[model samples]
Target: MGSATSSRSRASWLALLSAFTAGVGLGFLAHEYREVIVANPGIIGLTLLVVFAAGYLIRLAVRALRRAGSRVDTILAEELEKKPSPRPR
Candidate 1:
């Protein structure tokens, strides 16, 4: 059960990374071929592409920050565990 939980979290991380990478790549392609995309798909397609790319990037950033917060929390917990509590004067 523990291993399964661990694997699930790892898989989610991998998926997030893949999504962020793909978003960046697609966004670059869209920018590069902006005129063609606009011509064929028009305003709607371009808007959707931009929104998805931005949203993915934002999600990646937020995930990274959350991970960092958890790490910091774990470190603090460990330190608290190691230290003795103060006594009344």
Candidate 2:
């Protein structure tokens, strides 16, 4: 049990470190290409559009899933209520 917990903790730390390193590398690249990025207006607009579209799609999916979950909960509750209680011996 102790070993398993330690392994999970180590994995989590490694994953976080990897993500941080990647972010720093990306930051450097973005800084290096700042001039080129600024020169392309279309790229910025397209990026923003894609981001907004993705967010909208995710929102719709979450809403649909929540609705379905609520319906299931309601059905389950109704079925449980309809069940007759056992009589005392």
Candidate 3:
């Protein structure tokens, strides 16, 4: 369980890092293609719209994971409650 928690934490960190990297790369690419992007405002606007959607999805997924984690904790606590208590010495 400790390992599982650690893995999840690592995965979450990696995801955040990946998102940041992607955003940086995209920004650089946009800047490099500034002239073309400006000439075709529709294309640039569409691309940005897609990026915004991806960001929204990422936020939704993170929120869902947090909510699920709390539910898992509640379930684990309930299961532990059903176990017999240790006998007195």
Best by lDDT: 3
Taken over the whole model, the C-alpha lDDT of each candidate is 0.91, 0.91, 0.93
Every model's TM-score: 0.49, 0.60, 0.64
Clashing residue pairs in candidate 3 are: none
After superposition on all CA atoms, what RMSD does each candidate show versus the true structure? 8.4, 7.3, 3.9
**Count of steric clashes across candidates, in order:** 0, 0, 0
Model 1 whole-model lDDT (C-alpha atoms) = 0.91
Highest TM-score: give the candidate number: 3
lDDT of 2 by residue, 1-89 (tens): 89979998998999899979988997898899999888998988898799889979998998999799999999999999998888765
Give per-residue CA lDDT, model 1, range 1-89, as digits (tens): 89979998999999999989998998999899988887787676778899989989998999999899999999999999998769765
Give, for candidate 2, the lowest lDDT window spanning 10 residues: 80-89
Per-residue lDDT tens digits for candidate 3, residues 17-79, read 998999899899988988988899997789879988998999999899999999999999999
Q: Which stretches of candidate 3 lie over 4 Å from their true place?
A: 1-24, 86-89
Candidate 2, residue 45: how far the Cα is off, in Å:
0.7
